[model samples]
Target: MRGFGDAAVEEVPDPVAGPGEAVVDVACVQPSVTECMLLAGEPIAMHTVLAARLAEGPVRFGGHEFAGVVRALGPGAPDGIRVGDRVTAVETAPCGRCAACRASHPHACPSPAVLGFTGPGAFAEQVLVPARTLVRVPDGVTAAQAAAIQPLAGALHGHAAAAVHPGDSVLIIGAGVMGVLHTQVARHGNAGLVMVSGRSEAKRELAGRAGADLVMDAVGDVEAAVLAATGGVGADVVFEAAGAGTFELAARCVRRGGTIVMVSVLPDHAGAPLARLRERGITVVHPRSGGGVFEHALRLVARGDVDVDCLISHRLAGVEALPEALAITRDKQRYGALGPAQVDLFDWDRAA
Candidate 1:
């Protein structure tokens, strides 16, 4: 497993399933936030969080979240899952026997190696995954839709954490892919009104298409817009999906006692609004997917509660193309790709 932002792609040979694991003959690869980071040589934040538990050496496994068909299964694996079945995987594979996994927090597992980031990932022709990490794609869901399920989970988690209910107004702080998806997820959760604010005009339009009730310029006074749209009470929930410098506006736009949910990974070195958030007596939830969040997110996609296929705006097919794809997605909005830049990869023959 090797290749990080702009690095050479090496054919390290194919992989095989281990005991209780499964191998999916690669049919597609889902380009995610980590894919760009890995290709750019930027460190995945999870690495530091799990550094103490790592086995050392820079891991190159990438593509933790994607969908493909099960080609083979390890002996004694969970029986319901079988060969030729289509499925998506949870974020990263953690040793399911560790204290963290036992506690239903595989995300906090001691030894965490993310796929396509620090270890063998889905970008390649085949991927080896633990049996338990798999989530089946429903009959009606296309692979492209299934491919985006993991990210939707986090967005859903944000809405769930905010307790978004019918008729309640909501505000999303950015209009990038996560921001747009959060808008749809919030609407699906029955939020009465959903508004999105971003600096990019293109993103605002994307957000509107994704079900945003109103749009505001990120460079403008978004808090005032939210208040005006709500007749002065402000929104019920504020979503900080961009992890930008201005997320603190959530404190000003959310109604007193309303919730604020951070859905993106903010650059730690950047300033955080902890003090302002506390001063406003706001409760913030930064959801980490584990336990059943991914499954819940996937089920919604499968059931058509929230449609993410529209979020895809780009597709790439090989290691060589990944660097360019990563570059474009890193500044997804700058390139005028408001939603998450979907980079779908298929074998040359199959794609034809």
Candidate 2:
């Protein structure tokens, strides 16, 4: 296996799917999270990463969050999935026979081959995936929208478990993608107030567009700002999305009986201010994957209930533009990529 920070574009022959598989001309690539890991010299680092390419006929391409349309369907796949059908894909290649899968816990199967993180991914022109792996993109949905939905589903998993009640106020730490989704879900659940705390104004703007009512720049007295939003009552729910010194801010923002939802990966040493929670009788909501969360996320988009399109800030196509498009995220244009647009990966690949 290669060392971390060693991810480079290594070309392989065009793949042809065998029976029970489908070949999707990747229509879009969702960036941000995966690129963060790769930039840190950990090309293979991921939440649900598969082992590296072993004997190597079809090597890996590091894009797990993706969407596309089936260009060709292999034998044995149902005819309902025609060539022109648009779809989004996930990383879990579960063995349906496994105990975990039988219990609807495929994401946590002992052995799973995910799309880009673990297996061949959708970053390229054509991604070969099992027929069962793809989720049909609903009508009027763009590829970028679908691509973004996958992560939103993961975020929703935690939020749903927390069960934000109507008239409850929500406090979200970090205006990153996860934080944005948390705010959206909180609003959809009829939260009394949606407050987001983040470092950058740009992220705050994004959060607002995604339905946050009040935005707080957490550089100073974030905890106070949150309390003020609730008239000193504190928030009914808090989400630690930033995983920085945010636990204190989050813990302090919640009311006596409020709940805290941990949506993203936090450091091992990043301890929560548990004494506050214990004293307040606050519950910590920890949600796992599965539960057909993505399917629910798609339906939310289809209904136009969740304004996910507001969160997409950038869209780039083809291999040539990838390098520069990738750079904008780090420089002045980070998150400046605005207004959700459909990503057509097939067009980019064929053009390249």
State which candidate has the highest lDDT: 1
Q: Pick the candidate with the highest TM-score.
A: 1
Candidate 1's C-alpha runs over 4 A off are 1-6, 38-44, 47-58, 103-108, 291-296, 338-352
Candidate 2's C-alpha runs over 4 A off are 42-59, 231-233, 289-291, 323-344, 347-352
Residue 297 lDDT, candidate 1, scale 0-100 = 74
lDDT measured at residue 31 in model 2 versus the true structure, 0 to 100 = 52
The clash count for each model shown is 21, 6
Q: How much lDDT does candidate 1 score?
A: 0.71
Residue 242 accuracy (lDDT) in model 1: 64
Clash count, predicted structure 1: 21
